[model samples]
Target chain A: MELFIDITLLTFLCITALAITVIRKLFCAVMLAGIFSLLSACLFVSMDAVDVAFTEAAVGTGIATVLMLAALNLSHSREKCPPYQPLLALLVVCTTGAVLVYGTMDLPAFGDATAPIHHHVAPRYIEQSQQEIGPPNFVTSILASYRGYDTLAETVVIFTAGLSVVALLGIRDRRGGQSITTDRSAMKGYLVLRVVTKLLLPFIFLFALYVQFHGDYGPGGGFQAGVIFASGVIIHSLTLGRDRTLKAFPQRFLTILATAGVLLYGGTGLAAMVRGGNFLDYSVLGATALAGQHLGIFLVELGVGVTVFASMTLMYYAFSYRKEA
Target chain B: MDSIPMNVSGHFNYWVAIFLMMTGFYVVISRGNLIKKLIGLNLFSTSVFILYISLGKIHGATAPIASETFHLYSNPLPHVLILTAIVVGVATTAVGLALTARIYEQYGTIEEDEIRIKDESL
Candidate 1:
C-alpha cells in the first residue's frame, strides 16, 4: 500500500515538474510550484519524516508561494521564450542524469533496514536519545543537543539572507519618504476575507506557540513554528495592508529581533561555557544534566523561532515595499 | 543479468529522484527569465531533499519519535539535516528573488539575453 502511494505521488510530482518547465505564464508556474511542494510534503509524511514534512509544508508551500507571488506582482508574470533552442543545456542535463542514475545503482533498496545510514551513528540517536536528551522526538534531540553548532550556523545563514534582502530592497523609511497609509478603501470590499483572517490570526499564533513548545514531544520545532508564525503575519499583511502590519511590527523592530535571535542562541552557548561546560554543552547547565538540556534546547529553539519569524517577515516587507519604478 | 528486474524494481525511488533532479537542472539552464530560473533552482534543491529523505526510510518503521508501542523508527539523522536544508533552501530562494527584483528594477527586464544586450549597449 505504501509503495502504491509512493509511486502515485512520484508520478504526480514528475508531471508537475514537467508542466512547470513547459508553462509560459509565470503565474501558473508559481502555482504549480506550490502544488509540487505540497506533494513533496505528503511524500515526506509517507517516508516517516514527519518533522521534515511539516517544515516543507509550511515553508515550501506557504511562505515560498507568497514570496514568489509578491515578486511576480512587482515584475512580469509571463516568461519570454528563449531565442534559441536549449540543445546544449538539454545535453548537459541528460549526461548528468545518466551519471546520477549510474551512481544510484550501488545504493541499497528503499526501506532496507540494514542500509549503511541506519547503522553508522543513526542507531545511537534512535536508541539513546530518549534517555540522553529527554525528547521523544529524536530529530529535536539530535538537532538541538547533539548537533547544536550546525543549527546555530543555519540560524546565522537565515539572518544573513534577511540582511541581503534588506540591503537589496530598502524597507521604506517612514520618516523620510511618503508615509505608507493603510488604504482602508481598497480593503473595504474584502470584508469577508478581512473578518475571517482577523478571527483566525489569534488561533494561528496559538498554534505556532504550540508547535514551538511541543516540538520535543512531536514532529515540530523552531523552524516550522517560526514559518507558521510568519505565515500568519503575512496573511495579516495581505488582508489588512502592509502599513497596518508595519505599525504592529516595525522594520527596525524586526531587524533587531532577527539579530537578537542569533544573540540569544550564542548567549545560551556562552552561559553554558561560563558554567564550565564546553560551548553548547547543555549537560552542565542546570542542577541536573537533564534539566539543563531541556533548558538549553528551549532557549535555543526560542532563538531560532524568533530569528526565523523576524527574518521571514522582514523579507516579505522588503519585497512588497514598492519603489518608484 | 538475472537480477536486472530486481535491481530496477528495488531502486525505483532513486530513479524518480534522478529524473526530478535532471528536470530541474534542465529548467535552470534552459530558461531565460530570472524568476523561472529561480523556480528551477528551487525544484532542484527540493529534489535533493527527496533523495536524502528516501535514503533514510525504513520499512514498517514509524517516525523517529520515541513511542512505547513501536520499536522501529526511520533514521532521524536525515530528517534533521533536511529540516535545516529546507529552511536554508527558502533563505537562498529569498536572496535569489531579491537579486532578481533588483535586476528587474535596474535593467527593466528580467530576461537574461535582454539584460546582456542592455549591458552591451551601455
Candidate 2:
C-alpha cells in the first residue's frame, strides 16, 4: 500500500517540476515551485524522514515562495526565446541524461541494509555513538565530532557568500534613506504584522536554542536552527520593509557579527593549539583529556552555529540592499 | 543505457526524479529568464532531497521515534539532514526571489539576454 502511494507522489512531483520548467510565465513557474516543495516534503514524510518533512513544509514551501514572489514583483515574468536553433541543446541534454542513467545501474538497492554504507561505518556510528558521545541522536555526533571539518567548511561557505555579495554591491548607499518610493502611510498594513512578528520573535529564538543545544538529545541541530532563526529576521524584513529591519540589525553590525563568529571559530582552534594538540583536536581544551575534548567540541559547535546563522542572513540582507546603490 | 524499464520495476521513482532534475538543469542553463532559472534550481534541489530520503528508507521499518516496545525504525539522520537542507533551500529561494524583484525594478525585465543588452547599452 505504501509502495503504491510512493509511486503516485513521485509521479506527481516529477510532473510538477517539468510543468514549472515548460511554463513560459515566470510567476506561474514560481508558484509551481512552491507546489513542488510541498510535494517533495510529502515525499520525505513517506520515506519516514518526519523532521526533514517538517522543515521542508515550513521553509522550502513557505518562505522560499514568499521570497520568490517579492523578486517576481520587480521584474517581467516572461522569457525571450528564439523560434529555432534549440535542436543542438536538446541533443546535448539527452546525451548527458543517457550517461547518468547508465551510471545508476550499479548503485546499491534503495536503502539496502546489505549495502557497505549501511554495514560499514553507519551501523557503528548508530550503535556505538552513545558510548562514544553522550548524544542520543547520531546526527549530532556525526556533525559535531566525527565529520566536524565538513561543518566548519560549510560555515566558511556561508561567510564567503556574504562577502561576495558585499563585493558585488559594495557598502555605500547612493541616496541614503530618503529615496524609497513608498512612504510611512503605505506601512499601515505592516502594523499588525509587526506586532505578530515581535510576539513570534522570542519563540523563534527559543526554538533555535532548543535546536542548537538539544541536538544531542533530538534531531534538531545548529545549521537548521540558524536558518530558522535567520528566517525570523527575514520575515520581519519582508513585512516591515528593509529599512525598518535594518534598524533591528544594522548593516554595520552584521560585519561585526560575521567577524565575531569567525573569531570564535579561530579561538577554539587556538585553544586546542595552546593545549599542545593538532587543530580541532578537542582533547586539548583541558588537562583531563576526555573532559577537554568535550568542552572543546561544544565550544566549536557553538561558534559554528553563530557564524553560519549570522553570515547566511548577512548575505541575504546584502543582496536585498544591493539596489540602493 | 538499456533504453528500457525492463530491468527495474520498483526503482521507478529514482528515474523520474533524475529526469525532472535534468530537465530543470536544462532550463536553468538554456532558458534566458531569471525566474525560470530559479524554478530550475528548485527542481534540482528537490531531486537531491528525493535522493536523500530514498536512502533513509527501511522496508517494513517504522518511523524513527523510539517506542516503548523497541520496534525497528528508519534511520532518522537523513531526515535531520534534509530538514537543514530544506531550510537552506527556502532561505536561498527567498534571497533569490528578492533579487529577481529588484532586478525587475532596475532593468524592467527578468530576461537574462535583456539584462545583458541593457547593461551593454548603458
Candidate 3:
C-alpha cells in the first residue's frame, strides 16, 4: 500500500516537473512549482520524515511560493526563449545523468537494514537518543543537541543570506518613511483580504509557537516554525501593504532581532563552555543531563526561530522594496 | 536485460529521483532566463532531497519517533541533514532571487543572452 502511494506520488511529481519545464508562462510555472513542492512534501510524509515534510511544506510550498510570486511581480511574467539551440546543454545534462546512474549501481538496496548508513552513527542516535537527549523526536535531538554546531552554522548561513539581500537591495526608505506608503494605499483595495488576514494572522502566529515548542515530542522544529511565523507576517504585508507591517517590524528592529537570535544561540554555548564543558555542551547548563539538554535545545531552537523569522521577513521586505526600484 | 541489476525493483525510487534531477539540470542549463534558471535550481535541489530521504527509509519502519513499543525507525541522520539542507536551499534561493532582481534592475532584462550582450556593449 505504501509503495502504491509512493508510485502514485512519484507519477504526479514527474508530470509536474514536465509541466514546469514546458510552461513558458512564468506565473503558471511558479504555481506548478508550488504543486511540485506540495507533492514532494507528501512524499516526505509518506516516507515518515514528518519533520522534513513539515519544513518542506512550510518553506517550499508556503513561503517559497510567496517569495517566487513577489519575484515574478518584479520581473517579466513569461520566460524568454533561448537565443541558441541549447544542444550543448542537452549533451552536458545527458552525460551527467549517465554518470549519476552508473554511480548509483553500487548503492545498497532500498530499505536494507545492513546498509552502511544504518551501521554507523545512525544506530547509536536511534538507540541512545531517548536516554541521552531525552527527546521523543530523535531528529530534533540529533539536530539540536548531538550536532548543535551544524545547526548554529545553518542559522548563521541564513543570517548571512538575509544580510546579503539587505545589502544588495536596501529595504530602508530614505525619505523619512515616505516610501513605505508608496505601496500602502494600494492595499486598501483588497478589503476582504485585509479583514480575513487580520483574523487569521493571530492563529498563524500561535501555530508557529506551537510548532516551535512541539519539536521534542513531534515532527516540527525551529526552521519550520520560523518560516510559518514569517509567512504570517508576509501575508500581512501582502494584504495590508508593507507600511503597516514595516511599522510593526521595522528594518532596524528586524536586524537587531536577527543578530540577537544568533547571540542567544552562541551565548548558550559560551555559557556551557564557561561551566567547564565543551562548546554547546548542554549537560552543564542544568543539574541533570536531560534537563540541560532540554534547556539547551529550547534556547537554541528559540534562537533559531527568532533568527529565521526575522531574516526571512526582512528578505521579503528587501525583495518587495526592490520590486519598485 | 542482463545488465539490469538484481534489485532493479527496489531501485526504482532512485531512478525516479535521477530522472527529476536530470530534468532539473537540463532546465538550468538550457533556460536563458535567470528566474527560470533559479526555478530549475530549486527543482534540482528538491530532487536531491528526495534522493536522501529515500535512502533513509527502512522497510516497515516508522518515523524516528522514540517509543517503547516500536523498535524500528528510519535513519534519523539523513532526515536531520536534509532539514538543514532545506533551510539552506531556501536561503540560497532567496539570495538567488535577490540577485536576479538586482540583475533585472541593472540590465532591464533577465535573459542570460541579453545580459551578456548588454555587458559586452558597455
Global Cα RMSD, each model: 1.7, 4.3, 2.1
Give the per-residue lDDT digits (tens) of candidate 2, residues A1-325.
8877888888888788778767887778877887888887778778777667756655664346655664554456566773336667677778888887777676655655564545566666666655665466666666666666665665666666566555644555333555444524125576787788778878988887887777566656666566677777777676667766666777678778877776777777777778788777666677666576567666766776676667656766655565454
The iRMS of the candidates, in order, is 0.8, 3.2, 1.0
C-alpha lDDT values of all predictions? 0.91, 0.67, 0.89
True-vs-predicted CA distance for residue A172, candidate 1, Å: 0.6
Clashing pairs in 3: none
Local accuracy of candidate 1 as per-residue lDDT tens digits, A281-316: 998898999999999999999999999999999999
TM-score of 3: 0.96
- In angstroms, the error of model 3 at B32 is 0.8
Candidate 2 lDDT, tens digit per residue, B18-121? 78778877887778777777778878887877876787787776556544565556765666556556555554554565566667778987777778889999
Candidate 2 is graded, for docking, as: acceptable
List TM-scores for all candidates, in order. 0.97, 0.82, 0.96
**DockQ, all models:** 0.86, 0.43, 0.78
| Residue B120 C-alpha lDDT in model 3 | 100
Candidate 2 regions exceeding 4 Å error are A50-58, A61-63, A82-86, A170-186, A190-195, A286-294, A322-325, B1-9, B61-110, B115-122
Q: Model 1 segments beyond 4 Å from truth?
A: A175-186, A323-325, B1-5
